[model samples]
Target chain A: MTTLDATLDHPRGGSAAALLRHATALARRSLIKTARTPEALLDVTLQPVIFLLLFTYLFGGAISGGDRAGYLQFLLPGMLAQSLAMGGIALGQNLNADIEKGVFDRFRSLPVARSAPLVGAVAADIVRYLTVCVVMLGFGMLIGFRVQTGFVPALAAVGLSVAFGLCFCWISVWVGMLVRTPGAVQGLMFLLVFPLSFGSNVFVQTSTLPGWLQWFVHVNPITPLVSTIRGLLIGGPVASHLVVTLAWMAGLLLVFVPLALRGYARRA
Target chain B: MTDLVVRAEGLRKRFGKTQALDGVDLTMRRGTVLAVLGPNGAGKTTAVRVLATLLRPDAGSAFVAGIDVLKEPQRVRRRIGLTGQYASVDEDLTGTQNLVLIGQLLDLRTSDARRRAAELLEWFDLAEAAGRMAKTYSGGMRRRLDLAASLVGHPEVIFLDEPTTGLDPAKREDMWGVVRNQVTQGASVLLTTQYLEEADALADEIVVIDKGRVIAHDSPDGLKRRVGGLTLRVRPAEESRVPDVLRILDAVAAPGTSSSPDTAAGARPGAVSVPVTGDTALDIAVPALRRAGIEVTDLALHLPSLDEVFHSLTEGVPAKELV
Candidate 1:
């Protein structure tokens, strides 16, 4: 009857197939929500662009000792990392709002998989993550930040950033499901993400940091992610950072995915 | 389980310090409307949620169409549909989009989903606004859309929690029609409502709840009779003849059935009234009052309104119980 009808007639499949269909349908809802309220997309688009412009111009020369060009290449990857961290905050807040608005009540009553709404919601935000990567890439390039590597590695960086953001999103989803109010979700998620983004190598080199902060900077989860993106986008040692970042992603999934699903189950 | 479409026994739930449901029991046979009537915070909604498989009760069990609510919620979900107090449609999506999405989620083919959506939108008088985002809809429109979404699945049992809360009189009548139509199509409905009139109009059985307990349950007319079957009232043409009418009522109506304690003055100011078991009050009083040469301006026999029935059932308890 309409464009969405194309896959509507798939032959009845088993449990996993049904779950995928439900998730895809719900993901379409989230994407439609994003598209309708263009302002919602601004968090992924304009936000990263503003961060890129502000940090590069405000402290670039001072941080790099008058070599602003070198600072752009170093700072752009960190800006991408910041976008990845900030992207999930909206996911948690929106989920909290949806829960509060009683939007999930119908879904709760339906025969669909319990995990579909949360999983679909996280899945839809993948588009937002990709948007952030592209917006940051184009804006960073326009502002003289260049990828010093081949096109394939640059594409890999985009893919890797989105994957990391998806992992980070489970933490947001868990908080969103657990917290009672949207405002509290926002505040708590910021409390979680703020430290991860700021306490890492996103702004300055970990070696240049004071002794007490250096340890946290090295172990800070965002540090490895930023270092990995940097290695992928520029010519550097990608293997170790890549391994550490992959470990962090695995840990995030192993712990938070189940935790978030449990929170969702307890919503009754 | 032979003909019962829904049943709950000893369902209990507590929220922190508040006991929301204390052993609430309810049942309905196939193809009927069971109205769960209550005031605010009376736990009527809580009972519906537990039966709808959205919440698990603390102790007691529920069976929707003979499937255990606690053990197999998903199986129950497939056989039932729920429309909550608040409208649950996506505000960002069009009214048409919201219905189609729910239809698709329920596994209708795309063409079928859209076809179903268009049918529901037209039925709800929302076709003109089907393309508009639900956020732009009025409260009544949004509620109709929400109800439409629930019917997309055509489940055997439907739980409607305050389904007509915000509707106008005409729309409320339409909702009553919807409930009747669902029952006609072989669906049983568990409807929670604060409106006593709605229960009277639509329910085959009415359960009155208060403070998390079932205070009364019966057919609408049965409840009215149980409260006090009928009232015989008379007002004399001459104020001086009131005493004569009261005497006739006292003599003719059942002993101690006259609710009016003011024996000399009459129970209803200028009018004398007594609760009579059935048509006996009318047959006995009319002849006796006529025989006493009582000239009366007004004389009638009528069942107590549901409002009075509801008040007597819920408001104040037992100095002398009304039911």
Candidate 2:
């Protein structure tokens, strides 16, 4: 019979290395899973192309005073931003499914960083964000949206939107942990992203909205993200939204990372 | 350096209205498989989770692999691998991919992860279906994959929470072999199982827990010895002759021993068993039953099973044990 021992080296140092390894492993697995099954990124890829076709021809004359070029120019940034926001729901759905299937329990029992699963998931969604941006840009150019601010600023716009989308992914992780089923995640995320997408200027100009509604548009984080992308793509002095967008992204990450980590730590 | 690999002192945890763990104390040694046997919600899973560092105890402490789970949870996590009751591998990925993912999480290089994944797939006999999605695999196959994933890191201490609840007998034996393979490697295991024979076959030490407390803990043989030396159970073919059989058994069996009468008048009808005083006395009692005009259908003289011991220990305890 085995007896209890009193001595064994139980190293507790190097938590940063542990966390990094966990995050990278999570990201690699997610990327491979996406590669093996492309359905995860299909919505992010196809939605932007479809929106580019449906909106420019259908609403350009009515919304932009018959100036098709101006409508195409404004629609590209909003569509790209909306696509990233919509894809943020994927993280919540994936997490909810894992929780239901008891995969999270397996990870919970392991000796890794508590926040690794959520952090790894958030890290992987950055790749999804990049895929959506490239798809949106490629399709935007096919229809007639030109980037007047050159390649560097356009890349920066993509980076900012990706950052915002990643910050929102943490919020979804918390929501995912609260819900018991994957379908509930879809329902709640749709309710959240729809208002955040439409209440801002995704399809129409915020100036046309009533004064009370315009206040919400101005404060919405997605509003600044859309405006930042617009300023970067159209070459204008719109520095305030860019600064506010970065600040919001940083602030949300700061709050949600610890909150989501706490949620994960408490799980059975 | 005694071979103790697991030790806990007064482990306690509560979830609002329910006390999941009501101060459990347990111990196990190296190369030993200790079975924590309890009904559902008896803090079996909660105790494992505390030792695994997945859940913190509200009070008291536990030490796994010589590391305090509360003071140094990461160290405990490093030495332990846990396979939960359900299939926890990613179903969207293939069998090989799931093993590789766990290997990578342990910071193994890509080539090393693949090599280990390949080896595990072969060991679990899942190499033939390595490329198939885990979702498409049968329940037994998925459970095997989950077991294989836990071994990727080669942890010294393994916690298996009901490893064969939903498996066929053949598959359950296969899982038993996997566990034996671990023990052969000198790895310590804390297994929670409802299957009494599973505990008999695999456990070096058996801990019977009820209502979040360890009621009795000893070797499987030692626990059986608690009830008595031997039990003489007989089932006669004719229902009417059962009373004659019991009367003969009472006459031949030793005096002052507890005997369940086979009378249909009181309590359960036609269900009676009597415990003999000594293991050798059954030799004399068997022949006496044949002369009483009772056709014996089945008769056995053997040690008590874990189920009988459990029933006796929990007989008078409150039925609302989990709450």
Candidate 3:
């Protein structure tokens, strides 16, 4: 009989501790992957900045009644909200690509928590969301957009957007798990994200839209998130929009987290 | 009782209309290699997945390293490492980073994980490429890195699914050497492969499966004997001496075995082949042909190759006999 090496018998900690350790290890893997392939970060870094400059320069004058500065103030919050909504799609695409490459099978065979890969992937994506928020804010500052509600609320606004972004990614994770290909995940996410981002008040106010489209714009979850961020960064009502946005975040997590996990269990 | 590192009985799995595995049974003892040999879609990979606890069998029981796979899959996972068909290392991470990641996931401390990663990289001859991203490595290097990742935890059992399926012949041989080293280090391996030579080279026992069922299980030589014993080929120097050669072969050939007199007009025109029972046939035929005044160019004893055995076992035998 062959004897195994003593190093093979290293002690394993408790299950919860192991889960946290494994999730963190996987997160490190994602970060290394991002570092090596910085091109994957372009969506979060360049896309948001491009969208911010394009939307502000192209539509600011008309939307703010010839006052480009005032329009940028109104547009910055909505652009941040739109970027948050789009950030979840990157998580979906990454998950889908990992599945296609069969790395998830390797992860599944490990002595780690079943949810570690999903949770770790979504957690790692927070870095991308932060990058998008920073770039958007930094660019907005260059375009005469100021945070009127002081520094603490400005930080709070970024924190809220990230939290909402994390919650919304469960939907992307579920779609990624259910879909057959990364291309399909991209297409499906685009279909959902574009409608939610555009149909909301991200670009134009709800009252400016026709009556039929105004209903969707007013009720869209992105609308409350954008409204809440605007209230936090610039001068506006914060209480109702913040409450509704938090509720929407809670609702998304409640519905999509289990569904995504279940789908992963079946598919992976 | 001998210690069995892997055991599965009546394992069945289905994918909607396709029966991936039906009543498959396998056993592998400690520190030995068991090759599940089959063609594509023959349930070879399915069996590996079930025993590795990556997939649940529809109806059956499997145990790995004394842990029930279905009852406690996590326990089974702790005991097994699986190198899937596609090398599962993260493409964007460096080779060292990939191994370290797996080590950490296996619960090693940070320093220990780094030490083990370095150790495995050196052991697998990947030390030179340790700092390079896996995507930049060639297929063979990536595969070596993947195997090294699996060994970071020093699993008791390793499942290698077609480890050398797409590699060049030289790389395939390198992979075989690596697998041999793992088995020598006390890891029981369950390898799946469509290549017969791979099984013959590395496996102590080979299980032949087809259409989701275990058709035969035996040692390489044992399976070869089932199809036919050693083949004896005699080629006469002169075409006209073929009749005399045939007569010598007919006289000395083993009973109940077919002897072909080379009358066909293709390659080896003056050759005749006889299936003989054992080495004793060589003793009888060589002298008998000499006595008959027949000049022979070549007389050779050849064991049945795996290709012949596989063909006869898969296509010649009836389905009922496979069970």
- Give fnat, all candidates: 0.76, 0.62, 0.84
Which residue pairs in model 1 clash with each other? none
Q: What is the two-chain DockQ of model 2? A: 0.51
Q: How much does candidate 1 score in TM-score?
A: 0.88
Candidate number achieving the greatest TM-score relative to the actual structure: 3
The clash count for each model shown is 0, 6, 0
Chain B alone, model 3: TM-score?
0.81
**1 or 2, which is superior by TM-score?**
1
Which stretches of candidate 1 lie above 4 Å from their native place?
A1-11, B229-311, B314-323
| Model 1, residue B236: C-alpha shift (Å) | 12
Instruction: Summarize candidate 1's per-residue lDDT along A1-268 as a digit string, tens digits.
Output: 4443333323259668888988999999999999998999888998888888888888888999988889999988988998888899999889989988888999999888889999999999999999999999998899898899989999999999999999999999999999898889889988988888888888888889899899888888899889989998977888999999999999999999999999998886
Candidate 2 structure quality by residue, lDDT tens digits, B157-221: 99999999999999999999999999999798899988667887899998988778898898877
Instruction: Supply the TM-score for candidate 3.
Output: 0.89
Q: Could you give the TM-score of chain B for each candidate, in order?
A: 0.78, 0.82, 0.81
What TM-score does each of the candidates earn?
0.88, 0.86, 0.89
lDDT of 1: 0.86
* Quality of model 3 by C-alpha lDDT: 0.86
> Any runs in candidate 2 off by more than 4 Å, and if so which?
A1-18, A52-54, A57-59, B228-310, B315-323
- In the range B104-218, model 1's lDDT, one tens digit per residue, is 7888878999999999999889999999999999988998899898889878899999999978998889888888888899999999988777887899999998778888989
